[model samples]
Target: MESDKIETESLLENLCVGLPTIALKADIPTPKWNTLNPYFGAEDITEIVDWPEFNYNTIIHRYGGILNSKKIDCVDFSAPWMHTEVWHKSQLDTRLDELVRPHIIRTLRAAFEELEPQTQQLNLNPVTFGHGTTAITIGLFWPDTSFTTVAEGYAQGKNRAPGVLGISPKWSSEWRHSKFSNDQHHFQYNQTLAELNFYMDGHGARCGYVLTDAELVVVKRLDTNGRLAVSAPIPWKTGGNGQLSVRLGLWYLGMLAAEEENWAL
Candidate 1:
């Protein structure tokens, strides 16, 4: 754990602090991080990273130089403008493919199954890149699950970062019966809803993310209008990119190996 902690610190400093310093250093040969940055000064980048003596780090000092060495073919630090975007994108995607996909799939799958069967639709829903995708809400509706998810929010000024919001437990017998739902799990949804409220109140109009892995199970408000229509659950394995199949294969392989290993043990 201690080693893990050190590695985590190193990673944070390297990615957040060191890399930006190197970028600035390359851009401005003056060697001062603050002067190097075209947009914000070096101090601002340091404040964001919260790193001390960032410029003194060997990794930080040698970033551009090491990449400039003709020895490395794939990494082209030669182009001042393209190095950060091109190489950084390729490197991150490669690493995430190797590391993040498995853990992400496993964690989401377990959370989905532990929930009710219909809730499993969350896993099947196509993941979109904007807003509320990350801020997930798990609401309880007695014997069922129901929720309302916000899509995205507009950034403050121009193109900064948009705030995302979510609303769960839109209305349930559990909520209506009591002024405040006492169930711990149900209340957890309420807590999230409150936080989202603050975010929206501070920011602007919060939009709803296109519902994924969800069917409108209960529609109390629009009783006279009609019943809620739920899109048929998309098969977990069939999709345009075939990512679901790949994830399923990985999960199955993991289970088979675990079972075999258990027997041997």
Candidate 2:
């Protein structure tokens, strides 16, 4: 059974390596239309897509518009999910209040407090005010200083489960205090990292950090039609640097949240 799992993983690894080019080639449209005949010869390639008729621009507008609508934009900015430090909390405070009312905040907080007692009340710190597209270290727990090479530690670290990004988890021995030895050379911890900064301009977007926490464990599960879902894992690390890192761009964290909700339903 274990060997079969290894063989299956090896096949998937190879497939993943080739998927980018395959997807690029497959997405190109051709003018080939099928007929009732079992076989047919080549014909002049016609216009593949009627841009005016279908109007993909309108489609983008439709999708983006719906996502942009005030009705759908009913996310509570003050919610614990948006929890940043007190200083940084201001960036979201005034703007989020524009969308959500005090009553909503109270309701959400009440619910969260019941589910997780560790949730701290809003302190509205000012330290979290900043903006940019760069890497932010969410949190770091078990620091391993044993591995000789970062590549080795990275490979072992990635063996845990579903990886973040396509990089397949590389080690950062350069960040280590010393050489790595045991698998401890590869620490196991949780982080609430973000690569997206703000939504749009100042009107739609605000200058603030998305409130988050330390030691957020994310677990991936398979769904229908090759989709995936991620769920929160139980925090394992004890004391360490709990931070929130965000970059400016499209993010997959939203997808993880959606999957978690879908799985819950």
Which residue pairs does candidate 1 place in steric collision?
Answer: 33-42, 34-42, 121-213, 150-209, 151-207, 151-208, 151-209
Compose the digit string of candidate 1's lDDT tens values, residues 1-265.
4463222111111112101111212232232111122322112111111112212233224232321231211211222342242122233333223322333233333423333354334323211122222323223111011111212222212111112121122212133224444554444333332332222222222211111111111111111111111112222223222122222222222222222122111
Per lDDT, the best of the predicted structures is 1
TM-score of each: 0.20, 0.16
Model 1 TM-score (2 dp): 0.20
Per-prediction backbone clash count: 7, 19
Model 2 quality (TM-score) = 0.16
Candidate 1 local lDDT, residue 234: 21
Backbone clashes counted, model 2: 19
RMSD of each: 23.3, 26.4
- Scored against the true structure, residue 217 in model 1 reaches a CA lDDT of 15
The 10 consecutive residues of candidate 2 with the worst lDDT sum are 14-23
